[model samples]
Target: MTAGRKRDAVLRLLRAEPLEIVARELSVTAADLSAWREAFLEAGAASLKARERDDRDEKIDRLQSKLGEVLMDNELLQAKVDRLEAGGGGPFWVAEVEAMSPAVSISTRRPYGLARVCRVWGVARSGVYRRRRPADAPAMPRRRPGPQGPMPDAALVEAIRGVLLASPFHGEGYRKVWARLRHAGLRSSKERVRRLMRENGLSAPVRTGRPTGPRNHDGTIIPESIDTMWGTDMTAAFATEHGQVAVFVAVDHCSAECVGLHAALRGTRHEALEPVRQGVAERFGAVEKDAATGLSIRHDHGSQYMSHDFQKEIAWLGASSSPAFVRAPEGNGCAERFIRTLKENLLWVRTFRTVEELRLALLEFKRTYNEHWLIERHGHRSPAQFRRDQMDTMPLAA
Candidate 1:
């Protein structure tokens, strides 16, 4: 598709090279090379023909001028369509085409056909016809015009509201609600639940229009077994005595278990290493050298996580450092997700008087979360239960 590609082949043909030779050189078919050579010679021959003014020439000139006008009109119509789409009401371009009929004509005596006008403006012919129907014609249906579902719209919306309220977590989407409904012996499509949630404003508010770029990591971060990979992250909360304090957490990638939680007055390499140490002491027994030899620690490129001290400590404990992509928190989503849960159920709701108070609260929250927080990925099992079940099924000697 590069410029002068066919011309290069045609020039090679004109130089007396065999069509097959040129095609082989260019990696194109011999038929294509022959076609290009024929077109080039025909264009050259057409230019060399003797010409004079006559009726046929005059007719061709008139048609060329008309064609130029038609092309210019099409360009203008396209510009108008772009403006309408960007300014809101892009879908109503059929009405715009009908309104533009007087100005967009083939000639003074003959107006452009509705079909031609619709095509130029990228509007559908059916849309144009529907817009121009008799005033007394029946109106279109308000909804998508389909048979009713087993559940009525109002009932579905109420059901959706119930699902949202019953969930212990925030921001559970329609897909989860649909699954929950099916588990409760109700039947409905995911799209129907989505539509009902959207109409009633029961869906979670989410940020939109984020600049999407190429992703560095496109695979799952979750590992297949316990002690295989662990994700650690840090967040902040305000305390009456400390003003602002940092909270470090470590979570297992397989079971989503919050293995460690620590709140501190300052976030440093030493403070960040506390969670990893706590996790190793409890999960790997006595925190001896190489206790977590097979674990992979997933963290972001934070000052503490990337520090030499932190890397040395993780290696000493027998885990390898695995930092996520720059500015992408999703790479360490297990820890990131638990931080949100921590904020919603505790940090954002409670007022702590001191860093020690926050630390104690974090410890209490971690215990309850491991025992009660439902992970839908593991069939709504708690993290502690999931880890126990997974460890029981696995014969690994960790």
Candidate 2:
């Protein structure tokens, strides 16, 4: 394009046969024409001048446009980097500027220039330059230096380490280890003890138990009075190799405590009745029938619960069996909730084929559920703690 423009200008100049006339023809000043004329005279040909001017003008125009765009982009990027260095989500150049500021002071018109602040912080210029530091770098705690030695009671330390390794979810940070040591009647803090474990490279493979259960559906009711209602159901278990197993669970609606959990080979009417038999046997063994003051057992109308055999068992125990509305599991809300918790926490963690295997796992988890696991919604106390507190105040053997 520049070549074409120059050719047009030269043609006009040549046609005019004079500098002033050529300038007039080409719509340029006389000085512009004179500059072109001098080049034509020195180079000994008007064609040479035309070629140089065309190439030079093309380069200049291209560079000028690019420079303008680059300037705008640079300004935008500078603003963003400035914000990030000023502590937004920009780039690293701003931090580099901040880091470099202390070595040689530079004036920034901003309220707080980088150099002044760096001086106040007393950070070394060389340290930042030597390595790029991340945002999270400064927050890391340095390890304490100590004598390289074995624990005073190496045997006890080994014992604590074994327990932590054995339990699937005995997770406490270093601090918790310290607390656990004291709880286990050991004198050492885990912080100091961890040093030994670290030296030995002792660490457990952590596993997330299972996904949390779905939230309670709409219009679900929770019983408020003890013995007024109960929620019972069978949860299918997951295992390592074998497919699935079943656990019959009975929970007091108000208390939400596991009244009974019976692992069964098959999820049938008999399995569902086991918990009822156990509950009744515990309360009034050898009695053919007993009066229930205010009792209702809410459950889904699964084939097992709907069977005549299961209904007769509940009748024999003198407790009314209330099946939820067909296609409405939410009608028996409490049992569904317990089932969800059981599945996530225990059942989903493993695949059990044999009922005995499921039983062993459930027994351990049940004890932990009763004794160790904290229920924050229940005043951060375990189920056992809550029960003991309630039982302590009750008029027992009345």
Candidate 3:
């Protein structure tokens, strides 16, 4: 029964029967039945008020959650718009927007996904899909009909674009851009500038140089300590009369120590791992009698590093592997520096006719790197010597 009906039944029984009999029949205590009767008479409105208060609290929490999500989405949208306004329309932004935008499925009503979105917004789907509006159309000056009507100057729009292109803020949005144009003797509003920029697709920044090296999404910051981390990267050289050759290089993070270098006509995971494995293993054996020191191995997020085979090999050596962020080479600064050094000292100095010739040159360089080359950061000692000295002084635990 409803609470109100049950309360009414209890009240009727309480008046018709003895207290003990009524309590037993109703499966409620005499005190509880009396409280229900008194509550029905005295505070029906108060109980309803309590229920409404709970509902309001629930609604407030949901709205707060929604507000937080909306704020986050707004921030992301603003970032995208800012990037577009700046003219940074490289693949990065496109890829980023594609990843962020919600995937829509429309196998039924709309001809295109974008069209469907426009329809939902109460805009004509066909018009949005066509997007025939010219970039400088909105910026064109309007003139009233008279004996002598004025015409919009096309040269002005071109001049505005030229100013924007020469500007460092070419890829930026309208407010700052308008101020820049005004300073350059061009009178234009921010909206007019934005319209001109959007029409020509001159608003996005182009990727000018080589792709920045691999990046890690998890924010794996590079270490500052010498020997705390090491990075390696591969660069391919043209094959001689035989085939294409690849060079594997590893360099120390803090000391600029050339840890290892190897060359092969074609480098597989095994080829890359062999030289590194040998160099590290020899170092371990050099300090064999002492406790092992931890080493961090950093590399690009290539399939070679991420592969199961590569991970297993590193695990066997008891060293941790860290990958650089996607398209971010600054994290692997040492490796990049080494690559430049190798190109200057070895590759640039002499051209190799074969893989064997390249291998021989790399071997000679590796020996000098480990035993002969003195780095100022290492107090004028070679990598091997510095490593030996550090190990000799390191305390051993009982």
Candidate 4:
């Protein structure tokens, strides 16, 4: 009920002929009328009591309002700190100002006070005070002094080079290299690994950023379990004797394992189905109706993936066909990423004489990749190992 209506009803209950009579006229229960009358009488009594209580209530309201403002200011200050950390690199980040925003003064400013910023960032007051040391005085080392880890710098570089040389694949980054070093019982910090790689020219070439524009939609593509979702895509490669060949790939979103791969001269719908067919047979033990029940296939809107044959086959396998949004390749990023890896490691690096040769190479690469490629997301476990580990813990399929 509106406050005005409730107030009018309470007033009626006070001086009406009878509570039931007033309640009946207003379609409200007698109990509610009696409760309202009691509340009104209590409030009226309170009004006549110590005027100090009125002052106390008003003070409480003012304090609550002030608390809300303080909370909002804290949020804005937190965002400012986030902006500083996210600003990447800048001299302005040291103490005084931000490049994108106004000065965040470390002086006695109320919000960005020196003591408060230091507390939030966990910087020692002693270290911050050192900024006032004589300009020509020996400057603090850019990084903490001495070596960071137990391993010496030279030994670490040699180990990093050994990892790169021993790997059968190309384009492995310092993180994976670091993981491999640990697996070999050589411990080193990730930052030190990165530094040594950069200094010794052992790191992978920096990758170009993905083409940027406004994204139409966003969601994660990875699934929590194998066979829950799969992504399939096609890319073309050149073989010396075959001239050009189409490579179809199907990948499990959870494991990053190449469940199926195939190469053919014709990029037909049937050819596209080959990888999916192979995956179903290998992973589920058959390619008959409902073989892939509960699976969803994420693919692009290409003619082959959207073909009547392709859709029919997916349905026959008891899998739902999920066509990626137009112009949004990230929806099929699992397949897209595997294609890039395939190219960098095999298609672009090695030459095949025939389609058959390329097919054989793809099969071999799939095995190697499943057994060796260290996915950082899985704590650097190889795809095959991760699948086995998770499968051991996962309940048996019904």
On lDDT, who's better, 3 or 4? 4
lDDT of 3 by residue, 313-340 (tens): 7666666788776677777777886686
Indicate which candidate wins on lDDT. Answer: 4
TM-score against truth, every candidate:
0.60, 0.44, 0.40, 0.64
- Where's the lowest-lDDT run of ten residues in candidate 2? 104-113
**Superposed model 1: Cα runs more than 4 Å off:** 1-150, 217-220, 325-330, 367-385, 395-398
lDDT string for model 1 (70-96, tens) is 775666576666877788654546666
Q: Is candidate 1 or candidate 2 better by lDDT?
A: 1
TM-score of 1: 0.60
Per-residue lDDT of candidate 2, residues 269-303 (tens digit): 98897766655565345325654424677888788
What do the candidate models score in CA lDDT, each in turn? Answer: 0.83, 0.63, 0.62, 0.84
Higher-scoring candidate on TM-score, 1 or 3: 1
**Stretches of candidate 4 above 4 Å error?**
1-144, 396-398
Which rank order by lDDT, best down to worst? 4, 1, 2, 3
Give lDDT: candidate 4, residue 17: 62
Q: What is the lDDT of residue 23 in candidate 4?
A: 87
Which wins on TM-score, candidate 2 or candidate 3?
2
What ordering of candidates by TM-score runs from best to worst? 4, 1, 2, 3
